[model samples]
Target: MECLLGLLKVKVVRGLNLAICDPLSHSSDPYVVIHLGQQKVKSSIKYKTINPEWNEELTLSITNMMLPVKIDVFDHDTFTKDDSMGDAEFCILDFVEVAKKDLNGLPDGTVMKTLHPDKDNCLAAESHIKWKDGKVTQDIFLKLRNTETGELVLHLEWVSIPGITH
Candidate 1:
């Protein structure tokens, strides 16, 4: 049993129909916070809009594919504590599978045939393949959900390290 290190890239693209936390005002300032394992990253605040385009990227070193990544949307409040808008989560193992194509007894990258929503009630997102540094990278779109109230779009990439197993 050998362990390998993989790099996970998460890009918070945008939000759609986000929750308006401030009832006193017409709109609310919103931002996104992403959590992977013990690492957390926050996107820049988008003021006065329900739909915001962040286009921000964060990278994390991943050793376990069984863990789920958590994403939370919040309203930025200057006076008080930030209000929670909504949240969603997804697991890497949900997309990754053992491929029939193997190299030297190691499995190759598995292709996801269809986009499907996870247990978190998020919309199905798109996925594709990207090559970098002579290795395969799994790129996926993560659609964050606050039930039917709101949705967020995120781009996630899993970069595989050579000679890594499991």
Candidate 2:
């Protein structure tokens, strides 16, 4: 059985300059789906927009920190199947490591670490894991891979379960 590590709250904030999936309309209805092992969560569909503000919060029960959380953006369709917009992923290990340390003296908005986008990872730009509002959190900007044009902004927070034990 997989051991339950803790809960992670991922906030799908918005999309930026998404692809034009719909030809006639010049816009597309987009939604986000998050996959972490067997747990899959989806955000509500935002219609007729390249830049959509979802402000959706999804919680995932993390079993392994090494496993990456996959994110996919899709264009919703009423008749045919939804078209794939793009995909991105992020790991929680580094974020969790910083959260385990003593960050009492750090000022608000202090960046603990900066993760650069590379060929292996889907980060569009420099992602900063910051200490904000008395918690370990991250704001990520991902350039959608395998697509012509698209971007996503996400916020992540790790919550420790106090009574969880092996």
Clashing pairs in 2: none
lDDT by residue (19-78, candidate 2, tens digit) is 999999999999999999889999999999999999999999988888899999999999
Off by over 4 Å in 2: 164-166
Cα lDDT for residue 26, candidate 1: 64
Total clashing pairs in model 2:
0
Rate residue 148 of model 1 by lDDT.
46
* Candidate that scores best on lDDT: 2
Q: Residue 125 in candidate 1 has what lDDT?
A: 59
Q: What is the C-alpha lDDT of each candidate?
A: 0.67, 0.89
Question: Which window of 10 residues has the lowest lDDT sum in candidate 2?
Answer: 157-166
For model 1, residues 13-68, the per-residue Cα lDDT tens digits are 78877777777776779998878777888899999888888888877667666778
Give TM-scores for every candidate, taking all chains together and pairing residue i with residue i: 0.73, 0.92
Per-prediction backbone clash count: 0, 0
